[model samples]
Target: MFCPHKNSYLQLVCAVNPRIINKAVDQAMQREHFDPHTELPPAQRLESMQPSLYAPHVDITRAQLGFGRIGLRLINRALHSHDNLVQLQALHSVLDQVQISENAMFLINLQLIYRIIDLMLDQDPIIKEKVCLILSRLATYYQGRRRIMSRPVIVENLMRLIMRDRKEIRYAASYTLKTLARDRCACKIIMQNEQVVEDLLKMVKSDHTGIVVLHLATLTNLAEWDLTRALKANAFQIMLTLFENKDPRIVSGAMNCMSQLCKHDVGKVLADDYDLTFVLRRFLKSSQIEVIISATGLMCYTTLTTRSKWRAKESCNELTKLLVNLCCTPNLPLLQIRCMQVLINLCDSPDIRHHMKVYWEKKVKTINVRTHEEWDGTSETSSYGLETAHNYRTMCIEKVETIKNDFGDNAQVVNVHSYLRRIREVKEHLLQAINWKSYKN
Candidate 1:
């Protein structure tokens, strides 16, 4: 193809003739299905389709031979083409032949990515799939990840893709962002990007597998920017919801990210903003141990930070109870270490220290009685000399008095009694395990 310039008549030539290109593509397609992952012809048969790289020596247009401008033009033309297949082919060619330098980003040619993004509005499932792959590849590309992020238009495009009704596209975009956010600088760029947080927040309720993954990825990246503040801003609710997902990886990632985000100056603010005492109360009983552990660690850290910055309040006592309960659970040394660290940090406050110790003492007594009952083959009722067991035994008897004074008994008692029961059980289990070891000696 030739676009004539001046009297010099700049000649532009495509390496592959159109007819042969089609024929070769057809044969390649017949041999193997079209795979977007395959950048070029199959590696085994590269010898037959030895493609040459083209760098124009003479000015094809008005300006010098800048690789950036040429790449944009090629990418744009590929995006605008009415044929999806042709667009795919063009995208493949650009990704294959374009020489991206170190530290440079795909944003250098943002317009092309924008052009492809515009096509996302189309309803074709196949095209959307290809677009997902293209966006994903661009996001993960060494320099390309940064390049795509630099342009607001590209972020808008990605946000739109993420919000798409299709699950596959949503997952693809989420996965792409997750990969990109692995880079610390890239995460900061994403956090500062226009509407990234808002768009991500909206994805919180999405049922798609990819969107959930994407939400965690986006929050993970945002936390890296200023984890404490980012989470306090609104990620807490979404992260809490993600904690409900069955995928262990997502649960683990969300927990770890939430933990890091809560480690900053606003850590206490985040805990208070989310009213984590209530949230963790529920998460403590989560079926997934990883979720339980992470939730526990986050609570411990949040309480530790809040004690230092915020005014002393009953909230600290609630946090103490939560941590003491966590300490009563059995787990990896790392989790116990974190729980212990929380205990040490919280020790600075006499009230928290006392409250935690009281909770620990009660937990120990409960465990000791239960173990004797179990070993003696005596029922709990007879062993404890109680006619009836009541729920909410772990709840601070002082909690209701405080609430009654603060908000009158008219305030409906949030039935946190269940959480208390679970925590008591966890404490008993840990205590039993530890006591068994001492008796053996």
Candidate 2:
């Protein structure tokens, strides 16, 4: 039975029954009688998996031989005890077991989840701290996230606590919610609470860089679905302020959030009004790879207009060199692909095209042209291969020709736009060439 007042999915998700949900929640969390390792083969069809899909990942037979079962049972009992000390110790013990991941899996149940949610509002600061800690630990696991995200009370409380709680509690609560925010379904539930969205936007401006980073990470998730919520919250201005901070993490976080926010015409108008193109250009010089990637991603959208294009052309020398360097670097094919994309987008201006030609003639930068033929293991190839960057040089060369040959002296962007399609096609073909399935497996 569902709550009568809550008709929509958001209301349904955020609506909690306090003590328990219907029998469905109980049935979903029920433990299988047999060992999961023995019963369920590893899910080979990885692409078909849903966000909240729970796969039995442990060997219960081995777990029963060890103290894993007993430890979890004791923690569960202690958390339900009348004494506060017992509850505190049990919460701490949960934190320890959660590090092993599988042990944490044993501890998640409907009763304990709601009980912990209730305990989260305890008057004792220490108890509140422990409650947040336990929740944070539980939230790290897939099973824990599914349960916690299902109950939107945790999201509301975490946002409230982050604003009013002490440093440690705030951090703990932020960690839990940020972990849960990884689920898009959970993020939609969060968007339903306008106050929670506003609180996150407010928290992103916290003086504490660590707090700012965690909250910004959470905001990034919220931005993926409800960009308008953040846009109306004047998140763009807050992001610009955050970009002024010297901490690479803060700047990168702001840039990443802005990357999502700039998806719409409204966000783009804000960027043009705030001069975000100039803001991101400075970050291209950052030594941090994350900062560079985030800045470049923002650039992908921000540089779409004639004004931003002209602005970017002002620094086309540095842009060209950076794009060229990134494309030549093996093992960083993903970054290379992004670099190629930005480079192609930059070509919308003939001034930039002429500038690139003049700069290339003065200093022709090249890499191992055969980088496509072999994996150098130079740029973190363990997770990816150089396949995508195989034709990277060729793409750049064709781009050069597109710019120079399409409309030599008085080239129209209309023709160049048609020419740029081939570059994107190459990117698409090279993207498919990547053995992403093998890498993920």
Candidate 3:
């Protein structure tokens, strides 16, 4: 039994039976209904029903209910409310409903971005943290990122928050900054501020792995825009330090940042100062596929850089083993391709080529012996066993024949010599793909 004026009835309920209204609001805000598919509790359901009575006239209902303008008004009012509890509740309410597209659009349209940034200065750490969370959600979209970046003071405020002693505030600020850095213009704006880079470097040096991961991600995006700045800030060395961190997430983020840095000849820096070959070889054992992939990629770049060749050659045995294992491993196409590229680069050195040849020869022989044993045993057994043995033999024969084609008539040398030629051809094709000019020294 609801009144004709739904908003008025709700307001009347709030005034007359404030406890009942608060209880209903509390139930509605419970975490159980957080999922979209979950049904609300009966009281919350009743509150939701009050809005449906006027749903037939959608636009008129939205306007008359003031869901658009009033929600923002409430937030504004609560933001400036004298009571800290009221301020926290108001911000939390806006945050709770932010997942709804209409409410998010309303907040964005009302230009609450600036107001939320101002709220970041709230003396209460909880209020500051909540505001940062709101900003993080808002920065998830392109328009929000553009709007947030429009005001330079907002970026400065975020940087200040990043340096705050409170881990929660620093984390929220770092996350929001990471999201904002996704936009090219926003990334440029962030990188232009020298203190942002400095503050990020300081965080990287801090003992906190979680905060370090976020700052590393933000720096990764920033590095993508300007590798020189990243290098100047000693990002490469910092990432190298993170590589040794025990946390897999921090290690992965560092690897990703190193990979991006290597894209701009920062590999030269990695090659010169760090034992990248040893580092990458160690990473080959990582259980994480992403870490393995990133390591392989940086290994490829490090080996390709002129100064790193000596180090690459020194790790020829390890590199060759890594490549062979990746090649034989099933279901990892990306890792296989990247390993192959690095293998091709390493093949330029005679020592690496020799090591690879020995490695392949050993693999071929091992497979050949196994196939022969199976063939011998299958002849006196069932038809099924014979068929299996025949298939195995055929596969081995094809592999040997493929090697023979490249190495000519010498079967003993075929595996290694053929592999050398194949890798050279792959390198040539890769160079041609990128239209790289060859210089005669």
Superpose all Cα atoms of candidate 2 onto the true structure and report the RMSD in Å to 1 decimal.
20.1
lDDT, candidate 3, 178-250, per-residue tens: 8888677898888768778767888888747778888888888888888887787778888888888877778
Candidate 2 weakest ten by summed lDDT? 53-62
Number of clashes recorded per candidate: 5, 0, 0
What Cα-based lDDT does every candidate model obtain?
0.55, 0.66, 0.66
Rank candidates by TM-score, best first.
2, 3, 1
- Which residue runs does candidate 1 get wrong by more than 4 Å? 1-82, 89-123, 226-233, 237-261, 264-267, 273-275, 305-336, 349-441
In model 3, where is the ten-residue run with the lowest total lDDT?
Answer: 55-64
How would you encode candidate 2's per-residue C-alpha lDDT over 94-201 as one tens digit per residue? Answer: 666667766666667534677788888887676777677777777656677778777878777887789898776787788877877767777887777759878877
What TM-scores do the predictions have? 0.48, 0.67, 0.65
* Candidate 3 wrong stretches, greater than 4 Å: 1-69, 328-330, 350-441
Candidate number that wins on lDDT, 1 or 2: 2
Error of 3 at 218 (Å): 0.8
Top candidate on TM-score is: 2
